[model samples]
Target: MLSDPKSRFKPTSTAVADKSNILSALKQPYSNAARIAGTMRNAYLTNGSVSKVIDYYQSHPTYNYNIYPVLGNKQYELNDNVRNSYIDIAYYLRDLNIKFFAPIFFKETLIDGVTFWYKYQDKDGVGYMKLPMEWCLIRGTENGVYRYMFDITKLNDETVQSMPEEFQNAYKEYQSNNTSDTNTWYNNKYYYVQENGMAFTFDYNSLVNGGLAISPFASALTDIISLAKAKDNVNIKDNLDATRILQQKLPMDKKDGEMLISAKEAMIYDQTIRGRLPEGVILATTPTELENIPLTNSGTANAFDTVNKGLEQVFFSMGGSSPLFGGSTTSSNIVKEGIKKDANWIYANLFPMLENYYNSEIATVKTKDKLLWNIKFIRQSNFTLHDDIMNLKDQLTLGGSRTDYLAANGFIPAEIISKLTFEQQALDIDSLMVVKPTSNTLSAKDAEIQKRGRPKTDNPSDDTDRLDDEQG
Candidate 1:
């Protein structure tokens, strides 16, 4: 009655067509979507305000991260083997140089809504190479898993040869198939294999749309265009304002509009005026009047202001505060809080996504032994150190461990323990500290020595003895 239950799991015709079109579109030499991606990248490169917004995203305060084992959500001390394994992972991560790539990733993701990197191996070990967003496409998802494709035709021969053998073979087979069928050449002639580690994507816009990644700047594209036009207009107005015009007059005769001067004389006068004037000066003559005018405030008096407002609007549309690009004195507090919120949201979402992708796709690619570990990237800049200290203090007040306080405040617990042991045993630093008794302890011990209640000792010898005893 259900008519083959497995048939329901198959991809629909529309989904298949979409996937095919996505591949074909990206593979084409001049796809509009790819061009738009290129344009966004170029804007970030060329436009100062756009660059500032993107740099803000990239320049968020960075934090150190460590990988910890997830041992069933129970409280247990990490054994030496596990701790050493985590340390090894830390060293591997440092060698991987992910910190160097992270800013690039942030910039590209802000522009393209997605970033791609190719994973490869050589004598030095596993490495990642960033691939152009315009050359990459998603082939759709299978069972909630995404599969990616890259336009091999866009890549050079050396890069293609450097890929994994599986990917290389697939590319060669596609080339052979296409060469055999010259009449039916396809736009999606490039090749890719499924589930290969050759390429992976950082989809910042994952699941919001289908497989395709829509740029974050997509919605603000119209504002960006408008802002560009506004800037051009401003430039034109500024040029006009920098220009000057001159007017000259000659004495007129009273005989009923008789020419004050002959045409030849007028031409001579014009030449004289033009030759006398410097650059950016224009002149005109009339018999009745003479005036000189500079082209200041031409076209519109408020054109510069208009440009400024447009810039602010563009920054706002790009999900950035006006102060980030320039000055916004009136809304400084609001913008500061807004930026803080944006930082929190981005750190919460973006960092975790990157961490997870690195852990699953990169850190574990070389070996399976790291499957149990995850690199926890806590953003240190999300909160100020003072705020963190206060929170830790509150936590300590509520019966949290002092070791937690030390660890969370960027101190290594084991290193602190070892340092303290050495300081006590070798340096004898503890003996230098004079431990002062608390009020309650001192009161309980020296109750009889209250100066108001106790009389002074009259005997000089006894007084000297008491002083010696008190000093000791």
Candidate 2:
């Protein structure tokens, strides 16, 4: 009998408390940093244009990595623990929620300028949870030395209970020490100080505004507000246009060059228009005629176009191109080339930081396992695969070392050569292969000419007939 499908893997639990509510309730009046980070996070979650740019990076290929042995002039025996740790790291990353974390990572690093991950050990070795931006407070002077303040109240009672004994005891102590003044108590006790390595923080850019990174979307917020207002105006106009108004012209008397109508008669007409007309109707008595008027004209028809233009500005502000949205955009090639440039930038700037982080974290794990050889990480991704392949081709053509190129392509040249040699000898396949004529090997025509002794005169054209005669 087959086992239950749920038994195949470990179950994951989510936090029960509403973090937004906690932030709203516990937020200090002096700081808008949490609110600003919340806004940026919410914009990424709710806005299509913003999400699209982040999604492009989030959906980018997971890194391909190699663990290289780094032994510096020291005689060390490579043990099974050292070798297996590499496999353990690979599996841990594979099982981790990288797809979910990647978008948050990109959003924080690129826009918010900092990101935090709560690292913990589990049955799967190590796991990371992306901490809420609003609940996180950056403290300390230097960027490297800065510690993160994570609000413990953001986690519900169930989550707190599920935590380890140390965190549980802290939470209980906080609960016992709670006071009437929520602000002071919350500010001082609710926030748990996460030490440097315990909580992973990537502070890629310079900090500002009370150690809070300014959002890239801050400039585009005005444009977004304008777009919203414009959309509202357009909707209002459309609603007005949807209802047709009736125009009634009562008979008027021209007395002393002045058009006049009885007030009673006008009141009666108004009453009739209001009662009998379907909706959106008005009555007026005048010497001239009256006609139903439309709310807009060709002059004001560009309202929607203006909205589109504003949207384009917002897209650019969000570090995205119009072509990324992919609807009748003429710049597919532009965005494609831009993607290449982005990949290059990521490799140059962002990847080094990630490499350092992983190397340090995994080294700690390996040390616990009594591993001797220190492992170095080499990260690659499919984003630059085409360029890498082209460069490799060019280099090989220019007489680059095959061993180096093969290693780059993730091959062992010695193993490959050994396998080829085995096939050549054991299978004897080389004996059956036909050799093609090269400059060193004489061709059939040249051999025949050489055998017949080069033409005495300028009778090279007759060599074919002579060869045929010689064959006969």
Candidate 3:
């Protein structure tokens, strides 16, 4: 019998006490970082035109200023995490960064083991959950210490029932447990945990106004939005310019006026006769009277070019290059070099942060001992096979050793190259010997006679005649 697909992955919930009042008491400044990040994401996905992007930003300026950290966090998430972890920390960081700009990771000791949880705000009004970095907040900072906050309303009856008996018992004890301070419940309010050095707070050097990190793109995006609106205005103006109305001055006579009106109506209806206008209506007019209205300006083409340039600048400000997002593929070497420089700048800023996070949080004792935490950003190679081969040849010709060339191209280890070189030397030595021809080998004359049956007679025609006589 076949099983139901829905039954295989069941939804579970947990019951937990409400902590809204307690959470509200420790409220941090509200930042619309998530909204800005979401807008950027949408713009990139839809390839939003200047007008659309500007309109969105203008209507939500406060929201727009909060997106930089979110964007930076996402970049970190993408470049960090080369190895797949059990929890996929990169994925969680990406989600949090997109939604909250300020992503936080902290460890929690559960009944089963020590697990990490991402801070996210819960949709359910009851309270937050000990979930992945889905929805949560930085409640507030007291002195130099920061208290990470989350609500337990996300824990439902179904979730508890699914837990192992030991875990369930541990969870119950955890809920009932009280903090050292008598004023707060252990599970109901924000508590200060020692920073394990693994927690990340991606602010991107943003100005802390009212406890919210202001986005770096905020000022630059204003100009981009304006440009977008201007481009739209130019398009609208161009469309208006394309529209031409033909005006003809008719004679004051009622009959001629009537004929002109009829002709105009015919043209309007797209039903004008192929070769003739209405009778008495003349097609001929003075150059001054029948001139086309010029709608396009001399600089109309340049206006569009300017808009394109503005768009490229916007992309650059957002930590991207023109070539990255379907810009010119066959750019000049200087342009390509500029793109590499930009990429390196991003790497320089992002890689260190990722490395620190990995070293503090993700790196286990065993992994550290094995030196597995040394992170490297995956760079896209630009060299083709032919280019690589030419480079290798040039290097080798410049007196570089075979081992160095092979290792540089990642073809083989130095030890293997040495072994192969030794084997090749042996083969060359063996091939140096040459054997003399044996007596059994036929001479050129003997080989030709064998091929042609017998040697031809000096008088070949007479031989042919003799053969013919014998046959006869």
Q: For candidate 2, what's the RMSD?
A: 10.1
Off by over 4 Å in 1: 1-32, 73-80, 120-127, 140-147, 155-169, 178-190, 193-210, 246-278, 282-294, 324-326, 330-332, 361-371, 382-385, 389-472
Candidate 2 lDDT over 1-472, as tens digits, reads 1223433212121221233433442344125444444555565665666667766665454443334455545636566665455455545544444444544555566544455555666565444555445555555432234445555666567666544454566576677765334433346554545432222334433234443444445555555556655666677667666666565665555565443667687777778667776555444544466655665442346678877887788777665667657634665688777667666656665555555555554454444345533222223346556566567567888895554444446433233344666779887877777664443455556655555433323345643443444645
Candidate 1 per-residue lDDT over residues 1-472, each given as its tens digit? 1123333222121211122343444454233445446556666766788888878777764544545566664625555466456545555665556666666667776776665555565446455555555556665544333456666565445655545575576567666665333332234563443443322234434444433564577555556666676777888887888787777776677788667689789889989889999887777777766545556776677777887887888788887888755666676677767677767866775676667555664345343343356655545554354665577679787896565555556543334455666889988987887665433444422523642222234433543443323434
How would you order the candidates by TM-score, starting with the best?
Answer: 1, 2, 3
Q: Can you write out model 3's per-residue Cα lDDT over 79-174, one digit (the tens) per residue?
A: 332333312433332233321321112101101011123322233211112322212234434332233433334344565454334334434545
Per-model TM-score versus the true fold: 0.64, 0.58, 0.38
How does each model score on lDDT? Answer: 0.58, 0.52, 0.37
Runs in model 2 deviating more than 4 A are: 1-30, 73-104, 107-115, 125-127, 139-147, 152-159, 162-166, 173-211, 240-242, 247-291, 296-299, 324-333, 367-384, 392-472
Index of the highest-lDDT prediction: 1
- Provide the lDDT at 122 for model 1: 49
lDDT score for residue 15 of model 2: 20
Model 2 scores a TM of 0.58
